[model samples]
Target: MRTVAGTGVAAVVFAGTLVTGSCQASEATGFGRLHPEADFLGSSVPVSERAGAVGRRTASVSAVAPDGLPGLDVSHYQKTVDWPGVAARGAKFAYMKATESTTYLDPTFATNYAGSANAGLVRGAYHFGLPDQASGAAQAEFFVANGGGWVNDGKTLPPVLDIEYNPYSTADWAGWCYNRTPAEVTAWLTDFVTTVDDRTGRWPVIYTTRGWWNHCTGGDVTVPAHSPLWISPVASDAGGPPGMPAGWSAYTFYQWAKSGTFPGDQDVFAGTAADLAAFAAGPAS
Candidate 1:
């Protein structure tokens, strides 16, 4: 078991792993800690607050779909999920938070990952990135070593890198962009995506919001050409389909709502069920 120094609190162990003690304490008090895969975008800046911003779309939901295949994402926050219930509600796919930074595996990862598969949903894992705390390659390695590895088994989607606004930012700390210059941010992301791709033999999907991507990466940064995009735009504010970040023309998964017909964040695969299955299976051998 890995041990991390815990600020002023005694170390608390979860699922046989000891994480930074302050993280657990902060989470319990509902302050100063980032929850596994919580709706960071919505929490940091509300969708309503961004409605009038440039490039913000105002189209109705109908304009974006016949509605693609439905999905959802979860973490420990939705403790003891009813996966069978979720599938009954028409969720065809799911993503669960697996790891963060170079430590802190989500306590619910193994259960969520296995439960979703048992319920017949195409499931995968995501890593909540903390670029300021560690090297991208190091975090990616930690992620895979925990539960973020992907297999082309038709039941598993590529691992996802859920990089976005810093949930830990506060008044005294650097706000958005995690205190990194745009160049540094992009370089860190490149190292991460490259490392995950090299280790998994499949490009990890990139999850981020348009505003955060532009602001943090300075509208630059060439991501892996094959890395699928998982764009998160608030459904109510998305005029139609959300705009893509630089280097991606289409989104593979769109997280359009923080909550809805299913648990956790609501999502939709951009293609048919067959296409989703093919995506899970990876490139033809």
Candidate 2:
């Protein structure tokens, strides 16, 4: 089996190209219709069962004492993770960026997943789902290929399909000029999720900003009953923004901020220590 220090991983370079087009200011914000075919991931064995084989379980341990939640997001740049140390410090779970396109792999993905597992943090991986790609299946295949395989029978958390607007693309385009319409982007995301489920026997989690969820999905996609939702809402020091969406009981995770230090790296994540444990548990059996 391949081995590396979990804390040794880091982020990698984005293609960093610019595409130009004006983005609709109103396009950002609502949960679209959950897709009907989104029910595939529910059939996997209970999360506990999967973790059983992996051994040395500690998904329920308190990683942190409620400074909020204990979670981390692993990107190409966050190549280093002191898994055992982080878990000891207050980290309970991790979301690793696995792949964005066919050619790219988050530089630290394999090492981080292995290291995080070694440290006993419930872990999952996410693919930066891109709409521009001609076929969603191609991107999913790339993720599965380059993303590391499971180290043991212990099931990592379900994979995530991250549908955020490419930061580098957004930066290069100046303001949101190179982005696509919300409808177009949503369709691409839906297609990618469907293709991945068909291939992996595991349905993916959808991670999106409030704006992206509102504009792209807009009550059109059908989410599986078991699929977890990871929402991002940056609020003021006073508290969260007004009007959290309705019909989102499926919301199991969230990204409350973009800055500050997390257990694995300097990135952010959504979920308290308990929530992270629930996340690590995978879907309920």
Candidate 3:
């Protein structure tokens, strides 16, 4: 069963933190309130107002997302077909692969970023953080130097910081990190957010897997103000309330499936169409 949804940006350079220094995940961990008191209100954009509107059309049968905020995720450049065609497939926005760590970036980043624009889809980029470079300053400098162009306009969604642990990469990249514990990872991530925010004038979005959230962000981690969350869950149970972010109170994006015939991706984010709009609004920029 593949759960699905939509995802964004373009230029990016990822760095490995666990290998950069001794940052522990535990040292940076802090806690705050979780869950929003608000309800999941419906979208202000009516189904009849969608772009492909020709005749009387209801959301259930409409190709455009009911909320008029369809989206997609592009991890590979070659995999992208006609950017316009994919966008017409009801995709209003997208997330593109940027960097993976301090030393590497996704090979397909540039093309996908441009493709999303050509397709008329609002796009954003993300980076896979290296646990080794815990110094917020170092990580920020690396990220800005590498992917700053993606945020030139400050119109797209905030760049996403993808954090995950690769056991195979532990010895060389993950083990040497300063304060490598979950708390430390949280602190480093905070630093990354701060640095990126200062440089780009945009708060960042956080993307992580279920296991990482459980182990890295507990009641201890303090997510920046107005920070949105992009969460990936391997199972449907991950949809429960507890799956939401602690400080933010709710997740703006949720990756439900990793494999499927998604409009433009090998993976998809699953959430109400309104979530798409929120992503489009970007990081309070």
Candidate 4:
């Protein structure tokens, strides 16, 4: 997944991200393993306090994309999706992975962006948040500039910040694990949401699993009530509602399955198509 990779170099910061995505002295080219959201999240909850297959499975998830509305999030991993084919197949909306860290941009972003739009699907862009790579605001600014910005357009969904563990964190790759205290991580996310809101005119949705959140924010950071929660709980036996974020009552979107979908990541919405339209239309837009 890490293309355009290299070793040690300094780059310019626009909004805090390296514009060129130059090499990082701190990040060794030959690094460690990077875990997924499942490994980083939901592993701490007790069976009595958790949902789904309990004996140490991931925790509850809160999400958006509208409750019950079938949708998905795509990356280059899905290859070129047939937007028309996808819509025809019954997907109501989609969230495309646009950017990651300050350097890595998904090669499929442009095509997917246009494809989803042409398909009459409510689509939005998402940035894979790399907390250690750059400042949240800078990363957000880069995402918006790269085409993830949101508007009141009824056909488009709000932008999302995909926050989770990097897969390159293994002791072999970058060995990058977030070691910041919960407060620091919380501040970073707050700044990110605020920055994205400043650019898009609405708070961006948050995509993260509860376990990683707890690990990063001490399980107590209060996201703005305006920001929707998108919880990722990957369990075959996932049956109950996802675990709520610190201050949220429900998830707007939930990604329960990592595989099993064609052309993209499978997800669930909590609402109907009408509700989805309303959510993306924004207030007074």
Candidate 5:
């Protein structure tokens, strides 16, 4: 596959290291603690929503997953995808990257969004959260206007906030966000979430890693109870917490493999396929 680009520098290309529940920070793995820590506590989502088990098997859709419904998160990096081929493989849903910061929109978002749905898969749009670029609310408005809005249709997954590592230029490992305070991060998240929820009837899904969440929001950034958690944790828990972060008690989505054959990042939806369908229906009222 050819590289399509556009995930931004520190946003998707430089994925740092996946942080799970264990919060592993090892020099050997290049896990660096860039976020300042004072004190904060957290878990993930709600206890009842959590799968409460390690899932994800490196196999095809027919193969047993660690648990929950199966899906993928794709961006322009995937080039042109065969949405029908992916759906035929049993992917129940998919998330397409729509925008990053205020100026860059994923070039493949429009095609992927319509294609995935036409192929019979639940589809959602995600924004790569860039705290240093602009206010969260401003970014949210920009994102929504650019296709991040959601209607409670049973087939449309709510919008997602992809908040992870800081801006690190892929060419030289040069980073952007330098002195971002934890409080500032938390405020940014709150603004983004509230703005999105107010515009749409549903809260946006939060995609983050344990380390990024903790560092950016000072451990447990408080969002609406309805906002969902989508955590990315690497092998062996990455020496970080496993199940989730602090503010949440569980997770709604888990991105398990970045190199999985599923196209992009392979994920588990935290429940059965039926339950996942209902989740696609929209958040709890």
Candidate 6:
């Protein structure tokens, strides 16, 4: 048996290696609880209501509205999505949570992935990073093995790495950066992204918030140079995604709202339909 420090949970194994813990069980069986992508950035709350609570710059809705192809992202939290309805409502793309850490796979992923595709929405998968639980390479391998792999089929967007705040931060565990120093966080991110790139032949998109990026990675610029940026700024009734993090001059995708016209988190590609298609096709050789 293995226990996560401070989490008050122990992993129960049967075959001497099968790991089962509270978080993983919650994620796999759709019971109990685990964090979603927007939980840490405060996107779970509406922009209008979270003004003082967020205490960060909020972009005008006009500046950040669905100018480009609209999209949605979902996890098991948005259980039993209406993919056909989402497409009919004009969602051109989607990203679904596939795996988290090395032990948990989003129970809803396979169905969501197939449903979105059948509904004619270009789709991709994202992995929630748990840097403190295992090596980045291990998580990356696990993510790819489960559902985070990519193809150049012109309908599959590159896989995404959703690295953000430590949802497990509590009386037991370490704080936001997972108790790892800035350098350690950076190294872990490098390892994960590098491993994904090597396996998939395409760089994975990175989803993160400005504050988390700054605090966790020390505003590292190097990763942004290679990975496309998927930024989440708390959506306001009114401006753009928060300022670009470190090296990114522009964001490739913006998760503008937690709930809106779309079922899950509302998003928009930073380009036209053709550009989105090209993106799904992978970078030029």
Global local distance difference test of model 3 = 0.49
> Could you tell me how far off, in angstroms, the CA of residue 154 lies in candidate 4 after the best superposition?
1.5
Model 2 Cα lDDT, one tens digit per residue, 5-120 = 34333222223321111111111111122121111111111112221221211121222222445577756454466778777866667777665554344556677778887888
Query: Against the hidden reference, what TM-scores do the models get?
Result: 0.81, 0.63, 0.63, 0.75, 0.73, 0.80
Model 5 compared with the native: what TM-score? 0.73
> Tens digits of per-residue lDDT for model 1 on 1-285?
442333111223445546631244234332334544443223443343243333232322333332689998987777889999999988999998877776566667777888999999999998888777779998888887777787877888989998876766652224567899889998999899888888888788888877777777888648837678888774444567776778788889887766678877778899999999989988732
lDDT of 5 by residue, 3-27 (tens): 2344222212233443211232334
Candidate 6 segments whose C-alpha is farther than 4 A from its true place: 1-64, 171-174, 235-238
- Tens-place lDDT per residue, model 3, 80-105, is 45677776666666776555444334
lDDT of 6 at 165: 56
Candidate 4 deviant stretches above 4 angstroms? 1-67, 170-177
**Residue lDDT tens for model 4, 71-165:** 88887666668889888888888887776665555656677888898999899888777677678887888777776787777887888888765
Deviation in Å, model 6, residue 64 alpha carbon: 6.4
RMSD of 5: 11.1
Instruction: Rate residue 136 of model 1 by lDDT.
Output: 95
Worst 10-residue lDDT window, candidate 1: 3-12
Best by TM-score: 1
